[model samples]
Target: MENPSYWAVVPASVRYDKKLRANAKLLYAEITALCNKQGYCSASNEYFAGLYDLSKKTIGELISQLARCGYVRLDIVRDERQVVVERRIWCAIESPFLPADPPPKNQGTSPENSGDPPPKNREYIKENKTSINNTPLPPTGAGIFAAYAGEHAGLLEALQGFEEMRKAKRKPMTDRARGMLLRRLQDLAPNDPAMQVRILDQSTFKCWLTVFPLDTDKPAAPNPQNDRRQVTNGWID
Candidate 1:
């Protein structure tokens, strides 16, 4: 993430434009702040949604309106396989709030231009949750999880739901943490994809931090006779 500008700008044209929504003007200011070094903001809709306490769908609409009104330009870059690699929003007009000559890039923690300090307490944690929630999963860890899910559409969907649930609960998991979660789920369900989905869905629905077997399902247990153990009331004893 780029270091946000200390200030924002809303030019007269954008401020007075009757075609834009009131909140869209506010979004324009946010765009300026995020344009710190690249002359464009590359934040994802999810990032903006978390920052403004709005939905990604809503952010997309607002950005579209801004583009339509000539206040910003949207650029979408895709890889050879047609997978989107980046989304950039360029300001149509530069803001006076920006430095005449931009500072060197990637100097986020330099003393003269020190960005956010290290996290200290609950307040600071809450303040930075949005950024943390949007951090990309490490490629190796993510690939392992994807390999585990393979071509099982239901399992893949469950994984995405689990991630969204964590973000919504403000307890986003790191790639390593979620890898541990997947291992735990594997232990609980073994080779049953249906059971895995149920466990994940149950946790998401109940907003629980841990997974549990459904009341109707009996988890396979290690025994001389290969017996199954009953999970009464969906709670493990």
Candidate 2:
């Protein structure tokens, strides 16, 4: 079963910042959604690129912009292998939107404070804590493509070939274009990665970048001419 989605709270002041670009505003919301209780979001640039239809470079730029504007503090965390594993995001703005720190267990109400009973929401607190702590992070964009490549060799070859052709023609694929391709692949084959490769292969063969629903009724042949052509010469006349 799918987990319930959490809300990414954006402060009105930050949301309506006139100085920041529209992309920066949107990126802030995305980052906020992924942040944990400590305002540390561990998502990578590739993840943001895949989610926002932007290039990894663009995501990096936007994050830097947000940092400069005093919205977030970016910390690069490296693993024991000395490889950067996470981009720790700290929300610098002290807004109500930020998650509150959990209170200490031993801090009970004192007699001076009227000895009021603790709020009767222990279950709710436990549930919220579990949800926040156990929430799964999104995979990086390179991870997504790597997974597809591992399972579908033919499709991977087709994509590589297409990229090579584009490069040979001096038509480099833009970040936006790559994002669009990934989006389409996800849309067309959300459940089946292999099917996405097939679609990509078919599209590439036709010298087309756009993907459409496959005609399952038709034979899965490479040549478009294999399909019977109607006598259009007399019909059009």
Which candidate tops lDDT? 1
TM-score of candidate 1 versus the correct structure, residues matched by position: 0.43
Question: In every candidate, how many clashes are there?
Answer: 0, 0
lDDT of 1 by residue, 7-69 (tens): 677899999999899889999988776663435666777677887888866887899899887
lDDT per residue as tens, model 2, 81-199: 22234456777765444532322345464522322213452223223332323434432444334333432446556556666556666765765565566677667777466787678
All candidates: TM-score: 0.43, 0.43
Error of 2 at 233 (Å): 94
Candidate 2 displacement at residue 72 in angstroms = 0.2
Q: How high is the lDDT of residue 113 in model 2?
A: 36
In model 1, state the lDDT of residue 165.
85
Candidate-wise lDDT, in order: 0.65, 0.59
As for model 1, its CA RMSD to the true structure in angstroms is: 15.7
Model 1 misplaced stretches (Cα beyond 4 Å)? 1-5, 97-237
